[model samples]
Target: MELHELESAWKTLDAQVAQQDVELKQLRTQNLRMRMRGKLMRASFGQWAQLGIGLLFALWGGSYWFDHLGTPHLVAYGLAVHAYGIALLATAVVMLLHLAAVDYAQPVADVQQRLLTLRRTRIRSERVCWIVGAVVWVPIMMIALRTIGLDAWLANPAWVLGNLAAAVAIAAAAAWVMWRRPAWFAKLSMDGPLAEVERQLADISELRA
Candidate 1:
């Protein structure tokens, strides 16, 4: 081949390589955006479903309680039950609202920060649920005692102690699942989505560096 022809061919090859690099980068950016959007959508849908179910359950229970106002069956812990229901509904709404604010349009770092904030919020909400459960459990025990009669409850110290032990065990199990378990559903659904986003963010940081 002539020298001029060789030089022209090399220039063409370099230009093609540059073009492909640009196209590849563009494709990667598009893919990342799509993935983040999908993650946000899934998280939002899950939160919305939770909120809808919780709201329906709370309303249904509240209506039943109202309908049976002053009934003997609910007389002992009716107020407590209503309180617990309201607390549950409030937590669900808060979670839904927080998830709603999770915007994927932002930069990768911003999105990761938002997701981390959400994780913290979820942890706090779980703790709140535990506290509310304990609060409601007391009223439940009160109802149980009333139903069995105070005399019978006093006569069965072993049963009372057993029930207390069971409650403590259940609470401990829940705490373990929330804080220690590696494959919790909330982590899978919520944190799992952000894993890709975090990877992209790290990639971006490296590129910037």
Candidate 2:
């Protein structure tokens, strides 16, 4: 073969290689975007479902309270139930709003910043959940004890002290469990995807640079 013909063949092969590289990069970017969208959708749906359930409970509690409006004592009891439901709904709404605020089309740094903000929010929300649980549990336990005639039993000093200790123990256990539960679940659903997206965004930033 002529030397020029050999050179031409080599150039053709190089061009093909370059073209394939471009195509492959494009495919990878597309795949990453699809995965990111899937993560976002799943996270959004899960949050919405949580919020929806909370809203339902809140409404149920509200209805019960309204029905007992004339009964001041029962109305007070109803507030304990509403306290938990309202806290759950509020926290979920805050999370959803924060997630919605993230602009997916933004620059990598901006997206990362938003995600970090979200992580902080989740941490704060988890703490708030425990606090709310602790505050609400006392009334819940009181209501339960009342139903079992333990409220009257508490007229005795010893019985009152024992009941109060039991209530405190139950509340502490519940708060600890509630605190750990959401963090564990978020590791699988929320934190995992957020971290993956951050890594992907970093890669994209490097490529752009």
Candidate 3:
């Protein structure tokens, strides 16, 4: 009887979760519709955050570009610096283009299922984009490093140390986000939204008997 009672309680909990999931989905759709209808709202801070990052990169690239202007060795270090600067500009442009193309107002339920069934397939497409970007830009970084050479003045304590530190910080940030917000990239468990739907199924099962 204890086992049966425990099962009964679980079934009830499952049903409640399912109802909540359905409600959440409906609210999401309505929010999207509002967005597409030009009633979509973004937090004021989000806009400022985007603008601030863009402004910072702009200032950084500008300073980096201006500092290296009309250098003695145009083909060697100068060319590489220009190329690296261009890469930063290109990345910024691509990011903006991607932002422009995305229609976040459309809510697709299939996203959840797609994450499960097409992980490899989706990754292949994603990797292709990365590969193309790398093919174009990795050579630029390599050329820049080669041009500057390992023993150059700027390459010594300032530039090299800065690059390594930036790389480490990026890796740490990625790891932290992956751990704290696993669902942001991949589903951690079906227990979240799916389990509730299962409870609803259990309730229906009881009604049938």
Candidate 4:
């Protein structure tokens, strides 16, 4: 073959290889994005479910508190329940907002950071609820008894106080454990969709590097 012809053929082969590489990268990115979107959709659905449950609790607590305005003990119990419901509602709303703020079109690193933030927020909220719930259930139980025509608090103040003390002790112990060994209450597993998305992002990052 002539020298010029040989050079032309090599150029053509290089261009083809470059084009294929570009196409492959694009395809991988698209696939990763689709999978990430699916994970986000599942997470969003879960947050929506949480929001619905929070709404129910808030309404129930609000009604109970409004009805027991005349009784101080009942009012206190209702208010405690109402506060917990509000906390749940607020946490769900904040999580939904964070999820909504995630822009999939952004760089993989950026998206991964946002998702990690969301995961941390979820974990923190769960921990807060765990500690609070230990005590919150006492009020919930009190309200339930009241609904069943048993004013347990008024009937046996000592029993009610004992139960309340136990709840406080339990909540205090849980808080101490969480403060000392933060990983013990790690409810969210690393094998979830979020983790999968993170792995995909890491792969993409490595490719770019």
Q: Give per-residue CA lDDT, model 2, range 30-78, as digits (tens).
A: 6776676677666678778878877876776677668779866556656
Which regions of candidate 4 are displaced past 4 Å?
A: 183-191
List the candidates' TM-scores in order. Answer: 0.62, 0.66, 0.29, 0.87
* Global lDDT of each candidate: 0.64, 0.70, 0.43, 0.81
How much is 28 displaced in model 4, in angstroms? 1.2
Candidate 3 local lDDT, 1-209, one digit each (tens): 69999999999999999999878766755554444323112322333454455455445445544665664322333343344444444444443333333343332333323323333332232333333333323323533565566433344556544654665566566556656775654433323322333333334334334
User: In model 3, which range of ten residues has the least summed lDDT?
Assistant: 36-45
Q: Model 1, stretches more than 4 Å misplaced? A: 1-12, 64-76, 130-165, 176-209
Best by the lDDT measure: 4
TM-score of 3: 0.29
Relative to the true structure, candidate 2 reaches a TM of 0.66
RMSD of each: 5.5, 4.9, 13.1, 2.3
Q: By TM-score, is 1 or 4 better?
A: 4
Q: Cα miss at 111, model 4 (Å)?
A: 1.7
Which lDDT tens digits does candidate 1 get at residues 29-108? 76766776687567667667656655664665566567657664453355556666676677777776766776656766
lDDT of 2: 0.70
What lDDT is obtained when candidate 4 is compared to the true structure? 0.81
- For model 4, residues 1-209, the per-residue Cα lDDT tens digits are 99999999999999999999988988888888888788877877877887887788788888887997898988888788788888888888888888787887998778878978887887777777777789888889988898799999889999989999999999899888777876655534334666676777787777666
Which one wins on TM-score?
A: 4
